[model samples]
Target: MTIEQAIDSVKKGCKAKFDSTVELHINTNLDVSKPEQTIRVSVVLPKGTGKKVRVGVFASKNVETAAANLSESDIAKISKGELDPKKEFDVIIAEPRFMPKLAAAARVLGPAGLMPSPKSGTVTEDVEKAVEQVKKGKIEIRTEPNAPLIHTVIGKRSFSTADLAANFGEVMAAINQAKPSKAKPDWIKSVYISTTMSPSALVDIPDLA
Candidate 1:
């Protein structure tokens, strides 16, 4: 099925009481063990993710307008299990200098997929811009730790099919652009779209080479 048809099918199949998140799942052929084959990058969906994102910033100094300003002590607390970042924010943006400090909390944040990294544009000198991007539907896409599978929320079940299709196109474009230099010409193996409570609908994979 095409993206539009798949999205329509999934939306029709949604039976949850509340708005459900539409997700895109892709299977790839690259072996992630090779550093160059790893795919990790952030892309802004033009139509947005259809949900509010709570952004937290970790910096040496306070950022006046940041949703949540995290300090060195907060990082320490997270490393020691005294703080649970997941309960506070949906996304975390960090300054380059603070990355070393975040390492201690990696054991805690990594598994949750909230750890800030340069590859995902979460580690940068400009905290404000990063926060804005995230709030405006910027999302990180990466393959799973032990598999060549990529999964992420594309939009909401309530969104129009056209809007959902637009967001899906942007994600695919980003993924294609991030294709590793050494990856095979045909990197994507399959594509599927589904809402949180619905069965997945297999869709034709775009030309991602």
Candidate 2:
């Protein structure tokens, strides 16, 4: 389909207001080794999203429970007054000061968009919610600088085209709103949207005026 057709079909079928203009940022392509494309979005269905991720919290208490039991691929431990946040675990629990330790893993996790925080309720007094959301179909996204390659899912293929299109639009909006403070030099460089087996079809967003 033509780019305009794809955009219009997505907009109309989704019942979205025109305020959120469709966008197709340009002039960005980077080697996979060091992807210049910074933005990524991945979507998943509500039911078939796979096993829930187990979040291991590193806070107080003296239990030598097998770290293996932690639902995520890794585990972290933060002391009562530490000031560092390592690569974010599926869940995090520690003295607020230890948040800095995450600097080391920020480049790795931040770009993957896995750095869970309080706003998302991952860094809260109650660690259970963090665990719960991870298990649910919580779509994760990471945006590339200058490029619009958001890694997100549109859920199972059983979903109707309209559902996928509307879901896609919602995620794009979220990424646009989540621009980092450090990205002032040039927020977006290019746009590429596609699904699991498809080629990276370049995006052509209109001025919308």
lDDT per residue for candidate 2 within 149-206, as digits (tens), equals 4444444334454554555565556665554444544544545444333334455544
Candidate 2 residues lying further than 4 Å off, grouped into runs, are: 1-54, 58-121, 144-149, 180-190, 207-209
Candidate 1 accuracy as TM-score? 0.93
Worst 10 residues of 1 by lDDT: 200-209
How well does candidate 2 match the true structure, expressed as C-alpha RMSD? 10.3
Stretch of 10 with least lDDT, candidate 2: 66-75
The candidate maximizing TM-score is 1
Q: Which residue pairs clash in candidate 1?
A: none
Error of 2 at 5 (Å): 6.7
The Cα local distance difference test for each model comes to 0.89, 0.43
